[model samples]
Target: MALWGGRFEKGVDAFTQEFGASLEDDKAMAQQDIRGSIAHATMLAKQGIISQEDCDAIVSGLKDISEQIADGTFEYDVNDEDIHMAVEKTLTNNIGKPGARLHTGRSRNDQVATDIRLYAKDLTRELLEGNVELRRTFIDVAEKNFGVVMPGYTHLQHAQPVLFSHHMLAYFWMFTRDYVRLTAAYEAADANPLGSAALAGTTYPLDRAYTTELLGFDHAIPNSMDAVSDRDYLLDLEYACAVSMMHLSRLCEEIVLWSSTEFGFITLSDSYSTGSSIMPQKKNPDFAELTRGKTGRVYGDLMALLTTMKSLPLAYNKDLQECKEGPADAAKTLLDCMAIASGMLSTMTVNADTMLDQAHKGFTAATDVADYLAKKGMPFREAHEVVGKLVLYCEKHNKGLEDLTADEFRSASPLFEDDIAQDLDPEGIARARTTYGGTGHDAVRAQLKEAKAALAADEAALPKAPESK
Candidate 1:
């Protein structure tokens, strides 16, 4: 059932057949292949390159094959070089001459190029949907824990008090950027490449435009050689996935640290946790660790294709076959990791008391104490040194800034007042940050409103799928 070896006296050797086959990777694109064939056959008939009778037969046979592939009844052969050959050989065997005519204005090179674009369009949309859901989940988590206080860190040292809602919304914005990147990847994959026809334009009056519209692409690719060889869309997808995974890994790293006894800031749900075999008390955040580790894996996928395409001469090579697996793996892995993240987030317990207790330690409100003195007409630099001496005195005496008497505060600076105690309260300090995008309660609520609006707009901007396969 080999389709392109009519001139050869004998077939490839058995080992070579297995070694060269892409059935495992190509199987996922079976429906995309059928859809492209239908569009090509329809265009052939429209331009009078093939009879309408042949076009109808080809469409009908392709629809049946699509059903068979979907229903798990299609027989796949190991020696079928790729999915394009697999579908074409089956169609020719089942529907005879019209199926043979389906390849009139195309090559496997351009066919697979088109298939990858179609697959990318679909995959990108799916990833976008998951991305929106995860952002929404973070928003929900933030609103649920609104006004809860936590210690913000610089270099893992508590630097200021911030609302927990503000921290979660930080991730919402990170994923918002990821949504933009994924949208660009979809746009890159939206161009059609069907009529490239190997490396040169075909002699037939092949209507690439009609197929482009029929297959729901933005436009036909302008050059045959670039159309057949360009895999930049896959690179875009892999890059998006890699960056998104990096963001996810950062968040998961925090979760891993937060769930530990030293932090006790949060606890993961048992559903997303794993138990130690012998140590009964162990509830390991294995999934979070896996997501962090897989960020490098997605990076490898992007780099592998980049290395493969680096030295090749233009216009399709066997090395181009290495492109599909990386984008596919990275996209699927990113989607799965996002879902896991959302699940862990929605189910995990927030230790509010522990977080607030920790918020009070490390002199988390020290910045606000300096701000108070500065607002009371002291130079910021002088106020900073005054607070520094007070902090040292407290460290020696094993006391907090709040534990100092009013006279003791006045001895350091005449600007100190009894109301300075309010500045040292972590909750009040966090709420006092009223600037835009700050950690104040009002500021976070406004930020949450903007996040919801952004999510809604991006989801609406997603491309509408055509009704066909």
Candidate 2:
């Protein structure tokens, strides 16, 4: 018989049981469910609803079940429906009457909410740590490549020359914002909802505050109905995961582009690349491509949860059960992607020579030539037109601006002097951009220092996990 079966005369059909069971999906929350039960039983004892002896037995039985679950000795029955009922049934079987009292002043509605919140809090801490590690990897790669210049693009056309380190630091800031979102999600999940009972306050006297403290929650939920029905915390978590995955996808897209023979900016290590079954010479970035593809799965997870909660009424509903799997899958997918991407980045060989060779081929120094004329007292608009004509002439002759003589430069604009050739060098152009946050070497070093400090601060903010049992 099910835990709530006393009111029903007939057992549910097999199909119904299969459809309604959440045991497989929620088994991961067994530890959290046990922790919430222990706190609830203790609160019941403090409120005089259950005796101290009963609390002691309940806690002892729960601890034993926890150990069994951890050690793979616990037998899970399909009839149990979910981890909550499985643990409760096991407790009742072991401790008899006192185990029955463990549910006093509580309902599965509030209990499940509390369990999920606890689980979210722990997962949030984990993801925050992962984000910090990934960001550190980015910083390490950037610092190592500090002065390497690359062609900066607008609409896939070369617009300027930029330091490779500066380009990498842009991703650092994107992920740093992702860390902030994860922190906010953690705060949302930090409140205790255990004492809310089944959408209305419990009739028995209950010390909600004591349970809140025992479970390490910031506070108890203020209203039973809101507490039981709210899933905004889950939404917050999925949103964070979705946004973080988007950032990863963007990086993966760039990896795919950079590793191509056409770009030749990077080569993935053998461990991270795959060979074509038919084409012997092919080494494909399959992992990076897959990371880019899986980003849509995370977005679907977020949207699925949002749609599930859109029409529900004030209190707990069976539909909320559908919310669990999406966020769990999202979390797992993102963590795997982040770890693999970090490995790929840390191991892959950067083809600095190829990058440098291609850097100047796209006329990357054209802007510097224009800027040189603009600085020499020519109207900026006129300088831009003059450089446009000069670029046309160079293109007609299949020559670069760097191949032109100083006399040819002066013909375009007398403002161009003999030293104009120096201004056309890609490295010289990149170095002249010393403004803060620019692609200049000095600016990139300062950005790396700032990135390291940000990483350290994020590492410090993650909550320490409780000692494992």
Candidate 3:
């Protein structure tokens, strides 16, 4: 029988019963549902809404069910509409009348809200820790490859020379912003909604704050109507996941390019790579490509929930049932992607000599040459035109900018001197970027220091992570 079947004359049709069931997704929150019930039972007894004997029985029954759930021995019937119904029916059958009393002054509307908030709290914590580890990997890679210079690109064209370490650490800041967004999502889920009871506040003298303390929530939600209806926290979490995936996709796109024969900047480790089925020589970066493709999946998860909650009325509705699966999928996907990225990057071999060789091509030293003419008392705009004409001369002669002699340089602007070769050196061009946050060696080291400090602060703010396999 359905939990709310007392008002209906007949049972629901079998197909509709099966179609409306949510046990598949709700099963993931079995422990959360049990925990919220225990807190509510204890609070009800304190407020004299239920006798002490009933409260004791409810707590004992719930704890035992929790054990059954942990060991995978608990049975879930196909007819069970949700985890709440499965648990309540079992509790009533075992402990009889007191078990029936477990739902006193409560509703599935508020109960499910509390369960999702608790579940989101745990999920966000693990994501924050995963973020910390991924950021640590970036710092490790940067410090290990500190002195190597590579081409820096604008519009995929080499525009300047930059330290490889600086390039890697640029991603560290993108993910640091992700950490902040996830933390906001966690805070949004920290409010307790248990005592809101369906849609209106309960009339049975329930102590909402007492339950909040028992459940470790920041506070009881002040507005009862808002408590059972809103799923904004889930949206926040899914949005955070989407943004993090976008950042991962960008890094993976670069990995695909760098591992190609055309660029030859890095090589994937065999364990993180795969072989093409028909081509024995093909060592494809399939994992990176997969991560990039899954980015759209997470974005879809975010949009699904946004569309679900867009026009719902002012109180609880069945539409809220559509909220759970999306955020849960997003968080798990992000955590798994972070783990894969850490392993893939940590094992890959960086081809430093090849990167430096490529850095010297494409007239990457052109900006430094232009600066040279400007520093020699020429207006910068006129110096830009002088450099443009010089590049054309090199193209006409089939030579590079570095291959031009001082006589050839002075032909464009008399400001050019024989000693300009130092400015034209690729490494010197990279080292000349000594400003804060620039790609110079010293600047990159300073960024590493600042990044480490930020990472340590974020780690300290989180609970100690559980040991991982």
Per residue, candidate 3 scores C-alpha lDDT tens digits across 31-145 of 8899899999999899898999999999999988989999999988888999999999999988999999999999999999999998898899999999999999999999999
Candidate 3 TM-score versus the reference: 0.97
Candidate 3 off by > 4 Å: 463-469
lDDT of each: 0.92, 0.89, 0.92
State the weakest 10-residue window (summed lDDT) of model 2: 460-469
Off by more than 4 A, model 2: 466-469
Q: Which consecutive 10 residues in model 3 have the weakest lDDT in total?
A: 460-469
Give the lDDT of residue 415 in candidate 1: 84
RMSD of each: 1.2, 1.3, 2.3
lDDT of 1 by residue, 323-406 (tens): 989999999999999999999999999999999988998888777888888898988998889999989989999998778899
lDDT of 2 by residue, 1-469 (tens): 7889999999999889989999998898999999999888877888889999998999999999999999999999978899999999989999999998888888999999998998888888889889998999899889878788888888877778888888888999999999999999999998988888899887888888888888888888898999998989989999999999999998999899999988989999999999998999999999999999999999999999999999998898999999889988898888899998999989988888777777787788887888888888888888889999999999999998889988888888778888888887778888888888888887778888888988998898888765322
